[model samples]
Target: MGTLKAWMDYLNSINGKEHDSFFKPYKEGKWSKAAIISHMMFWDRFFYEERLPHMLKGETLVGITAEQVEEMNKKAEEYAHSGITLQEIIDEALKYRQMLLDKLQDEDLSRTFTIKDRKISLQEYVNGEIEHDEHHLKQLKAK
Candidate 1:
């Protein structure tokens, strides 16, 4: 479940669903599928474009505050509602994820990187993304 191939297969399984199914919130105060897609899309690009390259170069990542996280969530919600189709977001997210997998294809998962001086392996980071996606999947599937 930690491998890139596993993650891609999981994504492909769900990515072909109807767009309208992803447009509306499942319940009050919960995120719509569109917002979830937007959130994943944002993080996929962030990982591929910012974090992974820096990790490969052994550069430090400045700590992101709780407020910054809140802001990103707000931005994702706005993006989801700004008339962009859910399919577009899904496509871009998957593309970035593929880029990430490609970039890390021959890299050592056990190799460590520092984020705010705290060290972690690439496997740990990828697992975090899987956990995040699974959490949202559960929310979306809940009755």
Candidate 2:
């Protein structure tokens, strides 16, 4: 519940910003708000739609490669500049979060997964995503 509350607060704070500004590019070489949104959306979607199901099925979760991480960043940049609306990205993130919340209630939080050579539980992974989101949000707000 605290996590959900924090997410709601974060969403509310972003809603206060201008729509155009929310998706505007950050300083050159940095991720724009749109890119950040896409990154969040991607990870959220991954955890709720892919990773969670894999874990539930007792499948081995392979580590992420450095190349894949780079690709993810590249895709985020593409998504940012793709002319998709910020609200659409936000909605996707919300849907992903809700899916996680729903699944978490019934799943074992301690279930572990291997990603990038590290072993992390479902709870830890989700918290990492929240942290990543907040870091990007700060970057977005500072721009």
Candidate 3:
């Protein structure tokens, strides 16, 4: 939950025009703020839909491949620019993220997953995702 309030604050501070403007792609082929937000949304949804059910049941999962990651990102970016309202996307993300966190609250943090040949705990993975959120939040703030 660390830094989650900051994300909510930022999102709440923005108006519809500001939200829609985020759909404009950045220079040099970088992702726009809308794309970034949607990217986070997609990953959170993935965890909710694909990863968490397994994790909650104590199922060990293989890490997603690089290609799969790229595919997801691409789809997220596409969705961001596909004329959907930013509010809808953000709402979807927050919904799934809340569900994921709530479900994990009582779970064992010591649960391990092997990603790229290294063992990582659920706590560590969640921390990494929080950091990712911070990184993107900073980027969105910069624009």
Candidate 4:
């Protein structure tokens, strides 16, 4: 198992009780712990499943519109409240992450992709994913 695999396993260990604490709001009507997980899973799928393969094949990156981003966020929020189990979200995320890791070779790490009108390497993107996960995990722990 690689570092990514380890992280995925750690995420998979989270239970509903952990999710309840993780998703608890600082205030009412904000994103719950489940919503946060859904948001993360949404992006994991977007990047690994949708964007990464295109990027690896030298296809033009699809730019996200503000409306699309909003819609994704809204859908994520709904999914969070849909009574989906925390383990389900974790499993999906891990599967996607593993898919990404499998596709990424050492040389591919230096490959670049355009995001938000800026060019960033695959290594940068993977690092960003790890950082994003860590940040959310912190938020979950803080609740």
Candidate 5:
């Protein structure tokens, strides 16, 4: 299966137990799995709404800075506890994923965005998403 297909299938299989368990951090002050998931969803929404439009318009893209990434994590964690249920997160994640997937034409995958002064292709970015998903999924299930 495609990376997104497999990754999203794993997400679709998450139950209440998994969702609740995801909130358990391996160490204090670290991100819980749900927070990580929320962060991913935020970016998925980001590209779905922001990056895709720029690419579609053939506009230049901007790179995300470390400060911005930190802030995004903070925002995601805040939202995770802001009364949005895990189910809601999952639902929104699916929608965001679909939004991007719908635009993933071969031409779209060839699109590039400027990040860190480098041109990053949509295909490269999507691969990074899979890598992110795998990293977090392992941490989430680690004993």
Candidate 6:
């Protein structure tokens, strides 16, 4: 979770720096940095509110369909362009992230759950999210 913590710290450090690049797309047809952050914020909220509760109760996790994922991403990108400030997006994301971190503090990382017929442990799920974060960070940092 060190990478997670570091990612949180990086977000905090850039909360309201007023960088123009943050609002521009990295490439034509690609999501802007703010949209990428918004996408992450939405997922963090989903994991914290929709998944973690059931997961902690040892329930088989419900999986989201590809269409649903596409819809969610569309909505997130829309929200990012809906006049909301970048700082607000970061704050919301951090809040959910902190909740997630707090909730996992005493959790058994090896606890397994089935999502879409695939079995995964909490640790593996979190590691995947961490990788996702790293991938986006690189995208954001690229010129």
Q: State which candidate has the highest TM-score.
A: 6
Best by lDDT: 6
lDDT of 6: 0.85
RMSD of each: 2.0, 2.8, 2.4, 3.3, 2.5, 1.5
Provide the overall lDDT of each model, using Cα atoms, as 2-decimal numbers: 0.77, 0.71, 0.77, 0.71, 0.74, 0.85
Each candidate's TM vs. the true structure? 0.86, 0.79, 0.83, 0.77, 0.82, 0.93
Residues 1-143, candidate 6: write the lDDT tens digits: 44667668878888878877777888998999999989988998999889988777767877899999999999999999899888898898889889888999999989888787888888888898899888888887788
Instruction: Give candidate 1 misplaced runs (Cα > 4 Å).
Output: 1-7, 14-17
Q: Name the runs in model 5 displaced over 4 angstroms.
A: 16-19, 26-28, 105-108
lDDT of 4 by residue, 1-143 (tens): 12455456656567434445544563476677767777877887788778888777655686889999899988987887787777777777677777767777544677887866788787787787778778767665553
What does the lDDT read for residue 72 in candidate 1? 87
* Tens digit per residue, CA lDDT, model 5, 1-143: 14876657767777444456666665677777777778878988887787777866656778778998889889998887787788888877778887777777545576777765677787887888778777776766666
> What order do candidates take by TM-score, descending?
6, 1, 3, 5, 2, 4
lDDT of 1 by residue, 1-143 (tens): 54445545655777767758677886887788878868877877888887888777766778888998899888988998899876777777688778887888898878778897899888888888878877766675666
Residue-level lDDT of model 2, residues 1-143, one tens digit each, is: 13644664566566535577655567766667777877877877777776788876656788778998889778877886788777777777777777777878887878886665577787787677667766766676673
Q: What is the number of residue pairs that collide in model 5?
A: 0
Q: Candidate 3 residues 44-130, lDDT tens each?
A: 888778876766555567788899999999999999889888887777777777777678888897887665667778778778788
Task: Choose 4 or 6, whichever is better by TM-score.
Answer: 6
Candidate 3: regions farther than 4 A off: 1-6, 15-18, 26-28
